[model samples]
Target: MPEDLPIGRRERLLAALRSRGSVRVRELAAELGVSLPTVRRDLALLADRGLISREHGGASARTSAPERRTDGPRWVVGMVLPSLHYYFPTVAQGVKAVADAAGAKIVLRGSDYDPVVDREQIGLLVARSEIDGLIVAPELRHPQAPEMLRWLDALPLPVVLVERQPPSDFFIEQLQWVASDHRRGGETAVEHLLAQGHRRVGIFGTDNVTGMQVADGWRQALRRHGIDPDEQLMGRTGLFQRDARISAFGDVVERVRKGTLTALIVQPDPDAIALAQRCLEAGLRIPEDLAIVAYDDEIASMGDPALTAIRPAKAQVGRLAMEVLLHRLRLGHDAAPQQLLVRPQLIPRQSSLG
Candidate 1:
């Protein structure tokens, strides 16, 4: 019998046995540059721990008791947004569908567009150990994003961002997210306006990440047409304070005076309808005075003039977001992050043209 070996030596011996199936005491001694007695003692400890089997003056791989592997706890998904209204519900639908297929449950937490609330929700999830993973559409951008990511990373769980890009120009590029191609959506929206013979197309949207991206898309489309993206024609004032209604009203009033704004692409349909109603009250006619196109056809349909809008597959986005999350959860934290972009469709209606 050999004397007790150090923890490191025991580990090395176990690893060798696991890899090579079995090892003679002499061979283990020679491989680890230790005495035969020391190798035998190390093997004995491992065998006692049921990590190996000692026999024939040597050791073999542990085959009697298999190492346990668990799927961890049931997955808990976190969502940070204003509500389960028009867009969020669609995304939730997709997430839920995929989660069901993957044998996971979701814990949706609406932050009501508050970062503090989002932070608190994350703390709750971590403290409770209720969630194994997170798919968040952050209320704010990068510095805030890194904070959330760092916290989740420490817990050694998977976290995926859905339908948002980080705000601060910092490490947002490094994070993973699933979102629609708003730039292309903007281009498509503007192109639709142009096709209807309106050159001076105005765009309206919120100051959030999705809104900014759509605004950029609109500008890029205008630049592609050799039209300079004029700041005056753009209406997003402050990134935080600008809502769809306020921005739409500002755009309507500002452009109406300049008289260069002919057609418009409003990211939210409600805003477009509000502007149209304002215009109507001001004695301006739709398609005659100003042709408007809005995004999210479902929301746009509520107004008097059924809006021509860019309709991304709402249910599909939700379903696909869930699919992405499920795939991430299955792969675990060691897996590489993935980014998915859903395409958009343009729905023609009476607001833009007859």
Candidate 2:
């Protein structure tokens, strides 16, 4: 074998300092196969970075301390979101901006909107001691149930809920959560259509909590307007499926052709865009043939006929979640749980009106 190359001096010095609180310059120099002056220089640089403190003769390890009421952790912030789709990426960017200012690193994972995957990712994060805090977009309807809450309950650091809420009552009291008022968003969309004189409006969504809330908003709004909601106009797509989206849109188009639906409220921009396409292909003119208002305002920029949509304040949600999480980190355990409701705005386009 070739002669064993010397170990990096920085690695050797770090290992020595970790085992013992303090290490002499000569000892690190000898162990690292470097000169005494070089070892001292390395320790001085480490001290400058606040990684360690140097005494008259050597350097000492840092003691583990809880975050102060005004100062956040000097480590990592774990962030778990549902997906990189329509809105979550914007949330990630917002978190990144806050993390940059706070000098904390962010670790990201996606649930793909699946509870099982979310659980697995959460378990992996909780197992790591390097993670200082957790910011999660939890699935409201999860099959794992108690095990999931048990996992969250066991974490030592502050757990902040972002965007979506879990079903557990304990988390409701223990966690700081920030989300768009999706129920109000649903109500706003339906109420807009109703105000414009559309009585038999269709509501389409997934079976997820956010979806259910949006769907329920439509029903409640219709009830408020003295219109009996049509169950036939209600439809669900699988959590994340392109084919399910196509089928769902097709079903809605068939209903529209039969004169059952005069307006529609669909969640997220993906399904709304798909629905718009199917309606156009079926020889239906928007607003004249059928009116649509999507949950996310993304589609208004895409096509010739822009989709009228209810735009969730994604950037604001992301900014507020980070702000609350950072506040919790600085204030520690005594800080009260915070709940923020950011409003969603309605953007009207050609798809919903003349």
Candidate 3:
């Protein structure tokens, strides 16, 4: 969305197709200071190169119009993310950079955290896009996850999970994936706090796969230090719902006041910031009265105390997942299932250091 996006004519044309899902030759010609015939020629070359499909009056990305030149891109991939916002955009950038450079087509979609929507968007990609592979971060924690995962396993295409590892309780054969080591991130958070002489630690995260993983690590780290990972200290609530967070703030404040909790680990920057604000209102000093560690360091420093945070290698996960899917596509069903984990790093600031 830069002001100079329309500069490189061919690259710009392709980017337009990718972003808008289609582009008419006339509009592209007028926008690019070129003639209709020149645009048509470029479109033909691109179609022949397999980068796009030549439509009746325009060009379309694979997601909008089926491919006519299957011989262009080495592979056509469909990517389904949890959402288009937050941490996933960086991940998508990594995926696209690799794919575009490698002459591979990728169709991107967001599921908004709903498993049903995830499956539906994926269905459209499969049925209309003619994708040869998939890179997805699905809602694997849903009740319908078992069925949806089974459905995915049955697909003829190569599939790689990004930022999500399949649940072990299920019987789906080994799935290829690349994910952040969030469990270790949680462990690191606790270790940092405990090393600072805090024993009565706690966790508060949004109720999701990530929260669960971080909490799991917190428990492991605490038990290793002979401290109990009490249920009272770790709790899950909403990421965006202000009402739910207000109630959680009251509960957490009560615990801090009663001396049951001295430090906390919170996932996501916004929730952590919100918690810090609530603590300020209650006259509880960060790190002095309540040390904190936040997971996902996107804007974590914006908090009043400049929170310590866990930074996941989001772009690395995306790039690696895309690369793995390309390998899978080449090897087909004979390829070994790959599960890769990237570590998350802890950034210490006033929140925990003070």
Task: TM-score each candidate.
Answer: 0.69, 0.73, 0.75
lDDT of 2 by residue, 1-354 (tens): 111112244445544665576889887778777787777777776565444668888988643334432355475778889888767898788888888888877999988878777877775664454666788987766556555654554344567777875543554435677888888889899888877778778877867667887877777888887888765387764422455534566666677778888898877677777777767777888888788888877665584478888988888888888888777777765677787888789888887775
For model 2, the run of ten residues with the poorest summed lDDT: 1-10
Tens digits of per-residue lDDT for model 1, 215-275: 8888888888888778436665332123533334554656766788888777676667677
lDDT of each: 0.67, 0.72, 0.79
| TM-score rank order | 3, 2, 1
Which wins on TM-score, candidate 2 or candidate 3? 3
Candidate 2 regions with alpha-carbon error over 4 angstroms: 1-65, 68-73, 168-171, 238-254
> Candidate 3 has which clashing residue pairs, if any?
none
lDDT of 1 at 108: 77
lDDT of 3 at 91: 93
**C-alpha lDDT of candidate 2 relative to the true structure:** 0.72
**Which candidate number would show the highest lDDT if scored against the true structure?**
3
